[model samples]
Target: MVSTRVDELNSERHRFALGIFMAVVVAHWAEHLAQAVQIYVLGIPRPAAGGVLGSVLPWLVHSEALHYGYALVMLIGLVALRPGFVGRARTWWTAALVIQVWHHFEHLLLLGQVVAGANLAGRPVPTSVLQLAVPRVELHLFYNAVVFAPMVVAMILHRKPSADERALTRCQCARPVLV
Candidate 1:
C-alpha cells in the first residue's frame, strides 16, 4: 500500500518537483550569466552592473542571507529529488549532490564570516578557499557550471533510461515502455 503510494509520488509528482527545482536553478544561472556579461562584455563595474533581479534589488548581490538561502535550497532540492533516479542517472546525480554539498559548505563559511565580522585568510571580504585563487564571481560561475552540468546529464539520463536502468528505477519518470 505505502510502496504503491511512494511509487506514484515519485512518478508524476516527482517530475513536477524536479521541474520547479530546475526552473529555480536556471533562474539563478541566468543571474550569474547576466552579472558576468555585465562585467566582462559591457565593461560595467561590479557594484553598478546589477544582474536581472539585482538591478531592482541591488543589495541582493551582496546579501549573505540571499546567498545562504539559495545554497540551502539547492542542497535540499538535490537530496529530496535524488531517490527518483536510477543507474547512470543516479551516479551523475550523486556527483552533483556531492559537489553541491561542498558548494553549500563554502556558502555557509562565507555567511558565517560575514555574520562574525571577519574575513577568511585575512582578506578584506569573506572568502571561500577557492576564492583565494579565483575571484568570487568567477569562482561561483565555475562552481555552478560544474554542479549544473552533472545535474543536467542526470536529468537527461533519467528521462531516457536503458533497459537495466528502467529495471532499477523506482519511479515512473522514465519513458514508458511500448507494448
Candidate 2:
C-alpha cells in the first residue's frame, strides 16, 4: 500500500504536490519580503523587525528550530516530488534540490550552535559560515531566491515541456499546445 501510494503521488498527485510545495515556498518568501519591508520601509529596528508572523510571535523569527524545520521541509519537498519531472525540468529541479541541500546545512549549523550554547567565532548569536560575510536575514533571502529561481524554471518547463520531455514524463503536469 505504501509503495502504491508513493507511485500515485509521483504520477497522479504530482501536480497537487507541486502546487502545495510552491505555496509553502512562496509563503516563506513573503515572510522575508515582509521582514525586509519592516526594516527598510517601516524604519523598524533590525532587532525588532520580525515580519508578519514574527510580529505576533517574535520568538518564531528567532527560533532555530523553526528555521531548520523550514529548510528540512524544502529539502524533503524537492526530493519527494523529483521523480515526476523529466529532461530539462528534472535537471532544473535537481539544481534546486542541490542548493536546498546547502541551505538546509546552513540552518543545521545555526541549530547546532544554539543546541550547544556556542556561537560561531565567539559571536553572541548562532552564525552560519556565509553569515560571517553576510547578515543572517539577507543571507537567507539570497538563499531562498536562488533555490526558488530554479524551482520556477523547472515548474515552467514541467508544465510546458518539449515534445521529447512529454514522452518521457510520468506525471500529468504537461500542458498541451493550444495554438
Candidate 3:
C-alpha cells in the first residue's frame, strides 16, 4: 500500500503534490520578505525582526533544528518530485537540487555547532561556513533566493513544456497552448 501510494504521488499525482509543495515554499519566502520589511522599513532591531511566524513564535524561529528540518524537507521534495519533470525542466530542477544540497549542508553544519555547544571560528553564535563571509540573516536570505530562482524556472518550463518535454512527463502539469 505504501509503495503504491508513493508511486502515485511521483506519477499521476505529481502535479498536485508539486503545487502544494510550492505553496509552502512561497509562504516561507513571504516570511523572509516580511522579516526584511520589518528590519529595513520598520527599523525593528535585527534580533526582534523575526518575520511573521517569528513574531509569534520567536523561539521556534531561532531554532537550528527547525532550519535544518526545513532544508531537509526542501531537499527531499526536490528529489521526490524530480521524476515529474523532463528535459529543460529537469535540468533546471536539478540545478535547484544541487544548490539546495549545499544549503542543506550549511544548515546541518549550523545544527551540529549548536548541538556541540561550539560555534565555528570561536564565534558566540552558531555560524555556517558561508556565514564567515556574510552575516546570518543576509546569508540565509541569499541562499533561499538562489535556490528559489532555478526552482521558479523549472516550474515554468515544466508547465509550458515543448512537445517532446510534454510527452516525457507523466504529470498533467503542462498547459495547452492555443494554435
Q: Which candidate is the best by lDDT?
A: 2
Give one clash count per candidate, in the order shown.
0, 0, 0
The reply for model 2, stretches above 4 Å from the true place, is: none
Candidate 3 stretches with Cα past 4 Å from truth are 1-3, 177-179
lDDT scores of the candidates, listed in order:
0.89, 0.93, 0.91
Best by TM-score: 2
The CA-based lDDT of model 3 is what? 0.91
Candidate 1 lDDT over 51-100, as tens digits, reads 88998988999898799999999998898788788889989999999999
How close to the true structure is residue 123 of candidate 3, measured as C-alpha lDDT? 95
- Provide TM-scores for the models: 0.92, 0.97, 0.95
Q: Give the TM-score of candidate 1.
A: 0.92
In model 1, the clashing pairs are none
Write one digit per residue (lDDT tens) for candidate 3, span 40-61.
8999999999999999999977
